[model samples]
Target: MTTTASVQVYTTNYCPYCTRAKQLLTKRGIAFEEIDVSNDDEKRAWLVKTTGQRTVPQIFIQGSPIGGSDELHQLDRSGELAKRLAAA
Candidate 1:
């Protein structure tokens, strides 16, 4: 059986890390939902509520928060990202 993973990225305009994060996902052929918190107050609040941090590019796969870009890169390096993507 094959399952499609749902990835969500909470981001803002001009965040270089956000761009890099998206590039990484795109390079992996992963589709994702991008939320722009650049000017949306409600979105910002929601991001903070869900992640407990005001960081751009808060990623979630299968409804699990995977943290910011740095954390994501770490996961990729440690080989856990593949596992998560597979699970998704």
Candidate 2:
């Protein structure tokens, strides 16, 4: 499927969830921008404030926050991820 939505993923170096999330996106042929917050305290704090989640692999689609890996997988399972991406 072709994706028009811009995807951003906030991740950490040692987080397995981050890897899984990226792998899923890759498998689906979805392009994403990965932001590593492993060493940046400012970015991490901003992520927490923006996403309301103190976890790695926070994802955003078309500038809308979409939670983490499990949420992403759930959307995929529910067939909502493509629908969201296809939204203009």
| Superposed model 2: Cα runs more than 4 Å off | none
lDDT of 1 by residue, 1-88 (tens): 2236888998999899999999888777778889888999998898889889988989999888999899989998998988888876
Clash totals, every prediction: 0, 0
lDDT of 2 by residue, 1-88 (tens): 7575799999999999999999999999898999999999999999989989999899999889999999999999999999899884
Query: How high a TM-score does candidate 1 get?
Result: 0.90
Q: What stretches of model 1 exceed 4 Å from their correct place?
A: 1-3
TM-score for each prediction? 0.90, 0.96
Roughly what TM-score does model 2 have, to 2 decimal places? 0.96
- Candidate 1: the clashing residue pairs are none
